[model samples]
Target: MGKLREVEILLNQTQKVRFERAMERLQSLSSTTNNSVIVADSIPFNHDEAFLKGHGTSLVDGELLTTVCGVVNHVDKLVYVRTLRARYKPEVGDIVLLRYSFVAQRQSRWRVDLNSTQDGLLKLSSMNMPDAVQKRNTSVDELNMRNILAEDDVVCAQVGESQRDGSLLARSNKYGKLHKGQLLKVDPYLVRRSNLHFHFIESLGIDLILVRNGFIWVGEHTQSNDPMVVDDEIISSKTRQSILRIGNAIRVLSTLGFTLTLAVIMETFDLSNMENVQIHDMLGSEFHVWSQRGKLKEEHVHSKKNVKALI
Candidate 1:
């Protein structure tokens, strides 16, 4: 939705009306109470019951207030707001796709950037070595740490632990150094937590990783045992094109501020292919508007089915 003024000017009268209607439908689906707030606003709450303050909330002279602009959430007696745009908050066992912004040995651990508030720590002993041995890291291995993961390397790993000092612990195996792929960044809030993040579209020969930190990686499919192994052979043109098409579809969905899920992403890709929209054309303003219209139509059909079942 960023910088869409230019795109809006390109729309004709009918398209504009359709776009507005689709957006209105989307808004209607969202919880009005959940999403209506800004920073410094007093959150409406029951005064009779004792409430525990959580993240994005502050107490000011007995009044509960929000510290960030986002949707309000409550769990039992606890209340908090989930921020729409903020740095990634790592959780234990959450898979993350990260680019090594900088890597240096500090106190015998490798500190790497993960696009979070602080760099994550990857202790030498915690990583899966090339030999796949389980032993303490020797001084020689410490000297050769660069051979494992050098600077600026894009990698995937699971969040092991979060330290009291705010640093994160990263552990890796097949989710290590990435290659033969494209990395995309999106808002962390858009990606919903799920049991499975790694997906292989066998028909397209594409691997899609939806990292919890909002880093998405699309690459050629590889065996799970050796995910980081880079094949010297060239990727097929069809596979590359499919990957690009899927990635662009994801981009368009994210731009529309839609909640990103595997189902929605696949549907978008299928819609584009069914419409014979080229990969490049999928990024155009017209295609975006069309995609929204398509989504609205799909939702309308689904709602009608529900109504039929109810009757």
Candidate 2:
């Protein structure tokens, strides 16, 4: 309460009223689920009943309990907790955005941060080398290893089979270092897995990568990076604004606990343009109050339709 006051002015009377009502409506629509629980809470399931414990659950003195803070969810006999806010736990084949940690000199593997419990070991032999890095020679020397993946470079890769050494693979041709982008971190739960991760907004000239770990990348759309060409692509002001606009929309949506999909993101981006809101003003309290009313209503309806689908 004290901290929020220092950041900005509170909402005015009318905006406050509207915002409160919208919050009520939003909560009411989602109130059906009573399974959200926290750590050390005893689940109200019969101890005698045959039940299989899954992730986020533990047996404490023969009593089933949650080991983490998340919602309790079950699929038939298998019960697990769906974490709302937690450090990323990498799964098999998950497309994750990574930050370069360092190159392991002796092991000949690049260590990358996955926002997980352990840093992933990426073997030099496993990944298809990026075009941007000109190898000094075939040997994995310290100088050339730095040239391949410099310190603090952002990378996009896939989680491989969890090895004894926690090896992460980047075998796909498309998986490589990401450039010309803005990375936005949000709650991992808000981002659902999509059929395709890379998308191009033809109208805005922006490429949106929906990473599974909740690091959304919005950048200028480019098919390939040319090693020979100089890295001096000057983006027009309009395209730059489009990138910022889309990036802010993702931030605002995620802040509001809105389910982030490509469709809803475009809607939010388009709404800001339609209303003539400046890029900087998108994060203002007034804009937040104004945007949620209509968007929440639309999402509520869409969720219901999805629930009705038989197939």
Candidate 3:
């Protein structure tokens, strides 16, 4: 069966009970707009008038409400649904990736960028210390922001209580510290905010970060002289662009059955139309192509002077 057909079958199977309940509820209510599904039997405006915040409006066949100028259209199927609730929650015990941005010794509070618009505070008292270490007596200001969290060193921290306003607070060394990891980001609109945990890249064996801010990142943990080499300089423009185009296209087609695979021609070096192009050349050319397509009128083609080639 087709993918969409399979999806429809799955949706129907999962939502059968809920669908029946919604239809029954709709039949009992008096709605101004027709929100019912259009089945084979009767066309009674059907729709579940309940408005769920992030979730979509529940509608079945045969419900009625408002139609522009009295024209009526039956509900065939629901195209989308909203997440029921959120999965990720900030608490005192949880370890989180943190970025420190400000430090004020006099105030005895430090600021952290916890993937939120406003920075969170970290009180000095939260620092965990052994009794022996505390007795050594070191200078207080010695714990400078730069020393603790140089500009962008990612750290792990724990959530703390706010002083007055509702701004969040956190502390590292209180729980533990984060060293290195990858980050992955997904469109927030495409995911249910409450289901943040589901977006994690655990299956990929990489740390998944769902910053409260929309950005997410995923990085593989590498430790070796020859850790997974990513050639930064040698790729050609045309090849680079082709890779990105193919990647994006593959991503868009993921929900469908489209898959990219190396053909037999690629295994054997039959470099006919496929000239030896560098990664840089492919990337630059692809970028240029996109840039040219974006402009209203044709302009000069982008220069590929510094771009390198990749085998």
Candidate 4:
């Protein structure tokens, strides 16, 4: 777990011991090397071979040194440090959750806050028109950009490349303005990039978008449509409860610094139901401890299976 200061205060003596043991087990299971370093620390390098320093590293005093605090990584001849607490770094093809900040007239793009250092650009050309027609965006369309996605609307989009000037280009069809949903923010590192970011829970009829930028959206499942077109279907009370339950599962996993995955989320949901724990009570200290213990037990069983297979 990254920073459990808030969680630590809520745990009792036995819970604290159990939590510590689970964290120790997790740390032992991590594949990351012991090459963690801080700023200005000289990184041991191969002097004989030419090595390229990547992000979070700098050349100083004829030695390669780290410029950020993180674990060291190596790829071929390149060495880089993966910073632990930096803002989201947009990568091409990453799914991100953003809030529409404002429309930028200079570039004819909509500025969206992605919880990153630089706001991303959702260009008029990137979005699908209201009529689902693919054509050139005229000046009239540019004028009506606000009507398509107004200021303060939260959207899900895929990262296109950075423009010449360094602004990120965002494009999407399935992703656009989100509605009738709850947006939850978590540490970006917790979200592992995978083939599918969009998940439709068939049983609950809820849509879950696990953005690479650490924004999770839980809402009633709906077909992709233009933001201007609204869905008239009403969400049932049962579906609403399911959505909240899933959202709370995400929150608990995030708080525990567990990796967010569809399997893990579904396990948490199933655990809640099996234990007869209400959605509201999932956030309680006891349930948090219990959840961690459950995870630890699962991991132990998985490790035993791996060992047996090797034997």
TM-score of each: 0.71, 0.71, 0.34, 0.72
Q: After superposition, how far is residue 150 of candidate 4 from its true place, in Å?
A: 2.8
Residue range 1-311, candidate 1, lDDT tens digits: 11122322586644565456445533453546535455676877789989999999999998888887566788999999876666888887777877765446464566776778877776766665666566877778888777777677777777876554334333445667777779888888678778778776766777788877888988887765654455688888988888899899889877776666666777788889999998999988877778777763322222211111100
Question: What does the lDDT read for residue 255 in candidate 4?
Answer: 70
Q: RMSDs, each prediction?
A: 8.1, 8.2, 16.0, 7.7
> After TM-score superposition, what is the CA distance of residue 216 in candidate 4 from its true location, in Å?
1.3
Better of 2 and 4 by lDDT: 4
The parts of candidate 4 lying over 4 Å away from their true place are: 1-32, 37-69, 72-81, 105-107, 163-172, 224-228, 296-311
lDDT of each: 0.70, 0.70, 0.34, 0.73
Q: How do the candidates rank by lDDT, highest first?
A: 4, 1, 2, 3
Q: Best candidate per lDDT, number?
A: 4
| Backbone collision tally, model 2 | 0
Could you give candidate 4's per-residue lDDT for residues 86-111 as a string of tens digits? 57888877778888889886657888
Instruction: Write one digit per residue (lDDT tens) for candidate 3, span 216-256.
Output: 33333222222222224444454444433333322222212
Error of 1 at 248 (Å): 0.8
Query: What TM-score does model 3 achieve against the real structure?
Result: 0.34
Q: Is candidate 3 or candidate 4 better by TM-score?
A: 4
Candidate 2 residues 50-77, lDDT tens each?
Answer: 8899999988888777876556778998
User: lDDT for model 2, on a 0 to 1 scale?
Assistant: 0.70
